[model samples]
Target: MQRQLIQPYLLVLGIALTLSSCFNEPNYPDTPSADFKGIFKYTIAAGTGVGAAKRDSVVLTIGFKDGDGNLGNDIPVPKADSARYAQNGGWGNYQIRTFRLINKQYVELVQDVNKVLFFPDLTKGKPKGAIEGTIDFRQIFTYGSSFKMYPTKFQIKIRDRSLNESNVVETDTISVPFPN
Candidate 1:
């Protein structure tokens, strides 16, 4: 009777070990070394008259690569808030700046104070691949009664979990009309 009980236990343990061995853990990639890529595309809707709501928008896309898959932050908890954590907190991983072309020169445009930018969580096995993000801006520029669209450009850059800043990329000039 004792031999029978021990035999069943051994069989169960052997099965458990075999099953565990069959599963392999994922190996994540390291940090990226190449420069980040970005592009800016925009649309303009001219305002008819005063107090008319004009629609002006810009669509921005960015691409990145990281071998270690450490591009973004993990989910945040109560114990780990924004203030407590400084570097690599949660938001602002990707930096984007807008500029208006005037007289053959690019001038930086004032940004909205409440605007928030974030990086997607790309943490995965062999993270050394291309990651892309799309950002849209609408009804932010006002033209009052002007029907002409202003030429604009965008400068974008990215950062990794290790606080490494990638090379900056300036997008091609795009004309954006102001909102009335």
Candidate 2:
């Protein structure tokens, strides 16, 4: 009798687990939702190194924001909007995935068609977009940082610099009237 009850419970648990996993995340496609459009900005909180040369940030003017709000233009990294080391030399690298309004949760800023840095990783969490992380300088002329970006209101959280320390940003909601 006990074995019969145990088997049923085990079966139920297995099924529940499978179903829960599926429903936990919203279904999202690579393409943006139809009618979705906007020019959302992702601002990063700059980092600094102890002994590296300092430089100015280029103040990148992001170009295209698609229907689903995926960014498809080169963020003009002018000579100005780069890292400024405190001393001789260090590098900083940053990758920003430009957008999903609801599903994938961001407007991806993709300059290259061959690579993806964030949100696409559905294996980790729900596809609601993210701001990956941050980096001061992995080497000279390179600032290594990535984060999962979220739409609705610009918020910078979960900073990951150099595969080490991180600080996630806090945020509140901003209502955007749905488009007709």
lDDT of each residue in 4-112, candidate 1, tens digit only: 9999999999999999999764443444433324444444565566655655455555555554556765545234434333435443656678788778888887676
Alpha-carbon local distance difference test for all models = 0.58, 0.30
For TM-score, the strongest prediction is: 1
- Poorest stretch of ten by lDDT in candidate 1: 130-139
Where is model 2 more than 4 Å wrong at Cα? 3-24, 32-52, 56-180
Estimate the Cα RMSD of every predicted model relative to the unseen true structure: 8.1, 17.5
Residue-level error in angstroms, candidate 2, position 65:
13
- Model 1: how far residue 42 lies from native, Å: 5.7
